[model samples]
Target: MAEKTDDKGQTGQEFPGFDPKSVEAYVVKDPQALAMNFARALENLGKAASEWLGPRERGEIGDSVADPMTDLVKTLSKVTEYWISDPKRTLEAQTLLFSSYIGIWTRTLNQFSGQYSGQPVASETDTLPKDKRFADDDWMKNPFFALLRQLYLVTASWADKLVNEAEGLDEHTRHKAAFYVKQVTAALSPANFALTNPEVYRETVASNGANLVAGMKMFAEDIAAGGGDLRLRHTDATKFAIGRNMALTPGKVVAQSEVCEVIQYEPSTETVLKRPLLICPPWINKFYILDLNPQKSFIKWCVDQGHTVFVISWVNPDERHAKKDWESYMREGIDFALTTVEKATGERQVNAIGYCVGGTLLAATLAYHAQKKNSRIASATFLTTQVDFTHAGDLKVFVDEEQIAAMEKQMNAVGYLDGSKMATAFNMLRASELIWPYVVSNYLKGKEPMPFDLLYWNSDSTRMGAANHAYYLRNCYLNNTLSKGEMKLAGKTISLKDIKIPVYNLATREDHIAPPKSVFLGSSLFGGPVDFVLTGSGHIAGVVNPPDKQKYQYWTGGKAEGQYEDWLRGAEENRGSWWPHWHAWAEAKDDERVPARKPGGKALNAIADAPGTYVLERV
Candidate 1:
C-alpha cells in the first residue's frame, strides 16, 4: 500500500517571523509584563465564570431534563461498534492509521537527515482534504507540528471512512454519524488552541500574554451579552445598528400583527411594475438580511428596478406568542403581506418571493390557495428553499423523531426556542468556517473582528415559536410531508403539485442550508412552468448578490427535470449576479406599467418606519 502525500499542499504560503530555528525568539524575556497580563487574564476568566453562572443562579437558563449530547454519544457508539465488532476490521483500521503515521514519521526523519527533498514525499492517493486551519508553514516546515497535523488528519480521515463504509447502519444513522464525526473532529482541531496553533502561539509569545488578557476580557463580555451563554462575536457588533447603519432601505411599516409586520419600501423609480413584489424571509433570522445596507440591499434593488416591494418582518416570538403555528405564520404573515401589498399599491395581484423556510411556507400557502381558487399571487420566486427534505443537507440530522420530541419538550417549557440555539445550529453546520475561525481570531488571538454586515445579520437570530417550529420539523424534515403532498396546513391538505403559478426557483451552487440538489428536486414538485436557475455561492451571498458587483456566476436554460447533475450538465453559465436576469424574467411575466406607489396607500395608514418595530424586538 502507498502513502498519501500533500499533492494539494500549500507550497509558497508564508507567515512573517514564523521561523522555528530561533529558540530565543520564543523566550518570554519580560517576566514582569507577562505576569501582570497573566493575572489580568485570570481575572477576566473569573468574570466569564460569573457571567456563565449568573443566569443559572437566577433560574433564567432552560431546564436540562433532556441531554442532547446523549444522542450524540449513542450515535457515535453505533459507529464504534461497527468497527470494533469485527476484530479483523478493527485491525485493518488500526493498520491503516499506523501506516499513515509511520510514513509521516519516516519522511520527517529523512528531512532531518538531509536525505529527502523538501517536496511532497507521499503519493497522491494518500492525500488529505485541504484544511485551511493548518495553512501555516509551521504545520509542514516544523517537524513537531507537521507530525501532529498528519496524526490528527489520519485519525479524522479514518473516523470518516468508518462511518462512510459502515454496513447495516440505516441512512439516517449514517448521516448523523458522519455529521457528528465532522463536528467532533472540528472541535478537537489543534489549530483552535493557543498552545497547539503555531500562529496563536507566536502571538501569545510576542504579546507577552497581553493577547490572552484581551481575549479573556472579550470572552467575559460576550458571555455577559449572551446572558451567560457564549454569544461569540464574529464581527464588531458596535459598528452596526438595525435602522441607523444596517437595514437602511427606506420603507414604512404599513401593517402589524402579533405574528409579523408588513413593511412597504418607498419606490425608487418613477414608474413601477403593476404587480407589486412581496418578500417572505425566514423567521429563523431577521428580514434585514435582504436589506443589510444600500450596497447589498435586495429590497432596495427591487424598489429601484421599478417594483413596489413589501417584506414580512416576522416577530421575535416570546411566551405570549407560543401558540402561533405555521398556519398562523401563513395567515398573519405571508397572507397579510399580500393584503398589505394590495393596500399600499392598489394591486390585487403581486409577484411573491420566499427565501429558505419562508419559501417552504409560501409553497404551502400557494397549495392552500389553489384548493380555495385564490389567485392573488401572480408568480413566485424561491431562493435557496427546500420543498423536498429528501436531499435536505445536515440540518436533517437535528430533526429525527427523538431529537424533535426532545426539542419540543424544551420549546414547550419556554414557548419558543432561543434564537441563540438556532444561531448555534446554523454556525455548527459550517463549524470549520463559522465557529473555529472566529474562536481563533476573537478568543485565541485576543482581537476584535472587523465589522461585517452579513456576519452581523447572521448573529441577529430570531426565536422560533413553539407551535410553528414543531409543525415545520415534523411536516417538513421528519415526514417530508410538504414535498410528498401529505402536509396539511389549516383544515385542508396542501400539496406542492397544486401550485400552478409560474415559479422562478433559484438554487445556489454551494448552499449548505438548502442544498442545490434539494432545491432542484423541489422544482419538479410545482405544477407550473418552473424556471430553475443555479447560481454561484452559498445560501445568503448567492441570493443577495447584486449585478453591479458581478461576483459569482449563474447558470440557466436547464429544465428542472431528472437528476440535478443532469440539469447542471446542460445548463448555460453566465457571469455575474442573477438579480438582473431574474428581474427580466419577472418583467416578462407581466410588464404592465403603473406609477410608483407610496409606502402606504390611501387604504392602509403607515404604522411605523421601514424595518418595523417587530424586527427590533430581540429575544
Candidate 2:
C-alpha cells in the first residue's frame, strides 16, 4: 500500500485545500479532498455535539429524552470516519454506483430527444452532446420515472410510519425496506442527486445493476445469474419457430394470424377461396418465428383451414443495400409480392396479413392501390401495427432532432443501425421484464441464463437502413401527418377514410412499445368499419399466443360498428382466444370458392419471385 499522511489526523492522504468549516468545495477531483473534508466536518460536529450533550448526559434540563437524540447526532458523526478512513475504497464504490444510473438515465434521456436507434432524418444537424441529447426538462419529466419517484416517497413515508407506529414489527425486515426506500426516494429527485452524497447515490444507481433494487436489470441480465432463468419453457423451438396449440379450420386453406405468420394446419383439407393465401411478412425477423414448429406454428394452422399459404421471408440487409429506403421496400417487397400472389391464385383479390411495422406497409400498399381504384385486397388484418402515429409512447422520446442526428452520425459510421444496439434500447423500455432480474441470477447468483421462445426470438433482431427509419419517425410519429390526412404518398395524399374495406386490428394491452391507447386509436382513423380487439400480453407474445393454450382474455360484443369506441363499449366482456373470433369474422367475409394459383397472383404486376427478395431474408 502507498504510504499516506493527513494534516487533520484523518486516515487518508491530506488535501489541504478543503475546509468543511468554511463549507466550500475546494478540491474538485482529488480523492483526498473528500476524506479531509469529511474529517473536518466531523470535528466541528463533535465540538458542538459535545457541548450540547454534557448537561443532557448529566440529567439536567429539557426532558432528558433529548439525551438519546444528542447521542444519535453524535453517532451519525461516525459517517465521516468511513469517508476519511477508507478514501480509495469509498471513491471506487461511489463511482460504480452513480455511473450505473448515469448510464441508463443518459441513454433514456437521448431517446426522448429523438435520438432513436435508427436515424429518421439523416440530413438533420446534431445540436447536443450525447448526454444532453434533449434537455427539454419535460423529456426527463417522464411519466414512468415521475410516478416512480412519487411512489418511492410514499413508500419511504409509509414504511417509516409503519415501523414507528407498530411496536411489534420486525425491525430487521423493516430495516431493509427502509434502507432501500431512503436511497431510492432521494435519487428520485433527479436533479444531480449524485452531488449530495455521491456514495449514497452511487450505491443506489449500482443497486439497479445488481438487482439490489427490484426491476433494475429485469431484461438485460440473465435470470440464471440471480439463481436460474425463471421463464417457463412452453415448447421446443426449431431454427425459425416455436410450438403452441391454436384452434383453426381443418383442411387445405391458407389461414393467417395477426402475428404475421401463415399456418398450413391440415395441409390435406379441402381448399377454399379463389386464391392461395400469400403472407407478406415484415422484413424484421426469421420466417420461422411465424412457423416455429408443430404446436405453435400458425402456418400449419392455415393449411388446416384448407388454404395454401405462402409466406415471404426477407433477406437480412448488409452494406450492399445501404441505400435501400422505404420506397425500395414498397416497390420490391410489397407490390412485387402482390402480383405474384395474383399470378398464383388467378383471383382478383387476396387477403393480406401484416404485423407491427409490416402492417403499416400493408396499409400503405392498400393506399397505393386504392388511389387507382384497384381492388385486390379482399380483407386486411393489422397485428399490433399502427397507421396513425399519435401517442407513439416511449418510442417517441427517441424521435427528436438530436436523437436522430446522433443516429445518423452513428449509422453513417457503419451504414446501418447496428442490430444489437436497437435490441438493447427496446430491452431498456421494459427493463423490469427484459433486463435486470436475470443479471442478479447470473453474475450475482452464479447460474446460466434460461431459454425462452421470446428470448430466442428477441435475440434474432433485424438491421434497418438509416434512411428508412428517418423518414418513418419524421413523417409518421413526429408530424402525426398520417392520421391527420397530411401524409403524402405515391404522388397523392392517401386518406385512410377512403379505403372502405373491412379491417381487423389486434392491439396488446400490456405492450409498452405500442400501448393500447395508440393502437386502438387507429380504429377510429379508418374510413371503413374496423374490428379492433385488445389482447393480453406485450407486443410479441400477445399476438403469437395460440388459442389452444386458452391463456388469454379478450373483449368482444360492440355496437353496430360505425365508430371505434362505440364498438368497444358494446363488445361484451369475454374470455378465451380471439383466434376463434377472428376465424368467424374471416369466414363470413369469404366467397367460399377454392382458388389455386402459384404466388404473387394478386392485383399488381409480378416482380420476380413469389414472396419476393426482402420478405425471404429469415433466420
Best by lDDT: 1
- Candidate 1, residues 49-155, lDDT tens digits: the string is 99999899998985665575898899999988988999999998889888887887887776555555435555612576667898887777665677678778878
- Cα displacement (angstroms), candidate 2, residue 273, comes to 2.8
Error of 2 at 350 (Å): 0.5
Which runs of model 2 end up more than 4 angstroms from their true locations?
1-266, 559-570, 595-619
Residue range with the least summed lDDT across 10 consecutive positions in model 1: 12-21
The CA-based lDDT of model 2 is what? 0.53
Cα error, candidate 1, residue 371 (Å)? 0.2
Tens-place lDDT digits, model 2, residues 64-92: 11132333233333433434456774675
Question: What C-alpha lDDT does candidate 1 achieve relative to the native structure?
Answer: 0.88
